[model samples]
Target: MIAFFLQGLAIGIVSLIPGVSGMTVAVALGIYRRLIDSTKNFTKHWQSSLDFLLPFWAGVAIGIGLAVRLVAYGLTTFPFPTAMLFIGLLAGSIPLLLKQYWLATVGRKQLDRPLQLLILVISFCVALILALIQLNSPLSGLSMTFPTLWALFSLGVLSSVAFLIPGFSGSLLIMLLGFYALLTTRLMGFMHDILTNSLYIDWNSFFFVITFISGFIIGFIIFSHFVMAVVINYGQLTFASAFGVLLAAPLAIIVCTKALANLQGSISVVLVMSALLFLVVGFMTTYVLGLYSTEFTREHPHQGS
Candidate 1:
């Protein structure tokens, strides 16, 4: 149980990274197949799975708590540099993601070239539009508003479901959609209020946090089932769509400077130079980590069903 808990903790921590995949983390931890079976057959295996599931999820919850605090601090203190790092992570991981998929599906009729191209274009366009929408709005810019509640709710669903997708960084998708910082900050503040000033808490903040969290919980239960269906039915197209999202994300970030208005710097050269360095750091961080995870999986394969 302790080992399972630690594995869950690791997955939770890596989940915060836009480029790191929870599935990959689980694979590295040597529990990918068990985790999937436990999830997929919870009803039939409830008695057996609880030993793994409970402690794992508990660790995941705590891990998320710790990581969110770290992310919230970085976003609050160094918005531009931090985002650059995230973008770097995204950029670095893309190649690794492609490489793995290529090796796994080579000569396997992965995608119908013409249809794949069409889906890819559509996915890119949609990703860009959503990225721009989130970039210009209440959550992405961290200027939360009641009017954007519905939009935030929609994003809430994506946030909860993103981690479940294989080799895909849901956090990265959420960040590209402009909700990562806002969600983390709001979550941290809500947690702080619950611990420190329960009575004097701001009702508005409370409502915002509660609403978003409620949506997350609901989304998880409802969409977990939905994701499995889609993946089983259209796995290849799903990958294509995710690939498109990944491709458009960095471009979206580059175009959305106003979203980073909170960046503190009067000199463009210094800031740009700093951002470039952070981007490289982010890229290398994910690339190396993904490489290690891949090698680890290859060395010690688990045959869980």
Candidate 2:
């Protein structure tokens, strides 16, 4: 339970990065299949599913809550070094991905490696273009109306579809729909407002949350079974595309963050050394976690839990 909670925490924190995939993070932690299984059986086996999922969801909530404040501060205060740290963390997952997929891919000599290469290149370009476009997209302002409500529902539906595929950035898709900016502002705004003594809540914001989540839950359950079918039917190609997106995502992070641009000409030795140090720290952290997760999943599979 503690391990599941920690895995959720890490997923939530890293997932805050633009263009990063929460599903990829879950896969790296060795819990993606268990999560899908839990969700699949939740209706029929509510008790056992709750035992496995409760702590995990709690960690996700807290992780995102803390990351919201901390990332905002770090990005504003120590932009480049902070960005470097996250980039390193994102890059660190590549080794784990390679270890998991590359050998299997190579073993299947009949599979079209050339086609996979094409997918890798194409997906990389697609992710890069989306990130660049989103960096320029207007992200703030929302009004509660019929159209807005419909839009939120549509976003929820699309998010459910995007989230199942590793390396597909559901947040990036949300941004493309023109709601990402206002959605984030409202979330953080509500947090600030709720923290005040009055505990006042805005009905409009509350309604939006309920509507979006409603659509998400509906879509999630309906699509969960189908997604695994797609993955199994098109395993190598699917993962190849996923790897491409994963590779391009770090570059997207750099562009979206403008971390280097935030330096203000203070490119000192201290900054360089500090950036490198943090990068190594992020790398080692994921490397170790990914390493242990492999062994842990084999010895203590989540099925019995």
TM-score of each: 0.76, 0.82
- Tens-digit lDDT track for model 1 on 15-59? 876655676566545576577567667799898789899999889
Candidate 2 local lDDT, residue 49: 86
Please report the candidate that would top TM-score against the real structure: 2
Taking every candidate in turn, the Cα RMSD to the unseen true structure, in Å, is 4.5, 4.1
Across 1-305, the per-residue lDDT of candidate 2 in tens digits comes to 89889888877776665455677678767777777778888999999889878988778767767787776677677878877887777677666555545433442444666888998999888877877775787445668899888888878888877777665666656654555545555666666666774467877777776677677778878888777655545656776787877777676666666676766766788988998998898778766756654622353232210
How many clashes in each candidate? Answer: 1, 1
Lowest lDDT block of 10, candidate 1: 296-305
- lDDT (Cα atoms) of all candidates against the true structure: 0.67, 0.69
Candidate 2: where are CA atoms >4 Å away? 103-109, 169-182, 203-212, 295-305
Q: Largest lDDT belongs to which candidate?
A: 2
Candidate 1 runs further than 4 Å off: 17-21, 27-30, 103-107, 135-154, 172-181, 222-233, 254-274, 294-305
